[model samples]
Target: MTGEAEQQLRAYVEYFRDLGVREFYRRGEPVFAVETVAPAVAVASALFAAPEPVAERPIVARKPDFLEPPIANPVSFDQLAPLPKSRVPASEKAAALLAVQQEIGDCTRCPLAYAGRRKIVFGDGNPNARLMFVGEGPGADEDTQGLPFVGKAGQLLNNMIAAMGLKREEVYIANIVKCRPPNNRVPEPAEAGVCTQFLLQQMDIVQPEVVVALGATAALYLLGVKRSLSSLRGHWHTCRGAKLAVTYHPAFLLRDPRQKGEAWKDLQMVMAEMGLKAPAKG
Candidate 1:
């Protein structure tokens, strides 16, 4: 082995020894240890010599299950009945979404859809608002009311907007998934995927100057980022050419009120982008 490689191997041995991992083999050969001797030997070797490169193993390919045909032939596409025409158009996706609401006035896309009698929770507020807030999904009150962010969390969101000198009507609000998840839980990745097009269409129609992701899920869906809220919050990012900011979901702030300070800081960042100062904390 090269001198550098030998040194690196020695360092690895020392590191593992420091972590109390002794009785290791060298060059694929087993070596017995009494106690401190084994560890010291490993560390000494690591410090003095470089590690040897292990030989590459041959890769084995496995056959897929589909290689063999099923005993029973499946129904052919031509034999199946055609699906109903989608009113949503490629260009007028927003209008199509509204039409979809009318069609499935009461939907059952997810289990939450059937838990309670629900009206279509079409998102409310300004369709032309400059700033839009996108959340994870709906909850009990929101599911029942057919709106996004209308529970205690929604109320807090309203107060947050008010603190920015605006009302709910002045900024649009929506969610990554329109329907609530079962038990008010976060929407699954599949559910978010099913509903994401509608959100993209909604943003296209609204053409908002900025978007605020209310939580990690919203940030991940809208911005394709998977950073912690602490890392993502209070910073300005961008998505689809619009300025983006992230903050703790109001629901989170409700549970951990201490985080409201950080949320307020994120809001100030949003306000600064709008050329307005956030209201001073009382």
Candidate 2:
């Protein structure tokens, strides 16, 4: 057989292997058998050993009788229930938050722990800083490095802080959850709930003068309400005595450059509260 034909046969065998058709031995004799439709065998043989390669055959996937499109239910804002609350009080919540870190040390609470390398990203920057930045969660780089906002998004955040005439070390930065979500996807509601106390305790410790919700998740967690960032941005909401503001996360800004103008506006609002002037656009 030609090199191309041999390669084709190898691919065919691999595909059969994937479908659980393995070689077997019976009475000290080896045999390869595949239980497939007669038509499929012809197609496989043609692709694998034809003297002249033929055009690719169309593939049709079999659908199960029970396979139907999901039904869409009309959901009303009022019908949505509030998230379940943690019964722990402020003090106990703080202690439990610390304990979770100590107990889980390099946690695997979620499936994200298995992908690539990661370390438990607790948080960093002034534990007592009067200003805080809360992101949704870590990304690939942050997960591998075991730190929050250390990638390009992080640099943009640092620049945002510096625009307010403050350094990253001067303000506290954290996420809603300690560990990253797999494939950098958003955390499920239950996962967020599991990690909520840690963020709450971080707030309790820092007691920031202003809390900046870097995205919708952070804003929703702090305000206990579901609203678009547009409606929440450039305004101050009170959270446990600290003024809360919502803005597009640096990561979001990176994806949607158009929103950076509005983010800058939100940052100016925060700076105004701190008695600082917004940096002029060069």
Candidate 2 regions with alpha-carbon error over 4 angstroms: 1-100, 114-117, 278-282
Off by over 4 Å in 1: 1-117, 278-282
Worst 10 residues of 1 by lDDT: 74-83
Q: Poorest 10 consecutive residues of model 2 by lDDT?
A: 70-79
CA shift at 221, candidate 1, in angstroms? 0.9
Q: Which lDDT value does model 1 have at 26?
A: 55
For each candidate, the alpha-carbon lDDT, in order, equals 0.67, 0.67
* TM-score of every prediction relative to native: 0.62, 0.63
* Clash pairs (backbone) in predicted model 1: 6-49, 6-50, 6-51, 7-50, 10-46, 121-146
Candidate closest to the true structure, highest TM-score: 2
RMSD values, in order shown:
20.0, 14.2
**lDDT of each residue in 1-282, candidate 1, tens digit only:** 966455445543443333242334555443344333355666566535554455632222233222244323222111222322332334564564576557545544433343333554567777667888998888889877878898999999999999987889989898887776545667655456556655666666566788999998898777665568789876788765568898999999999999998888888888888986555578
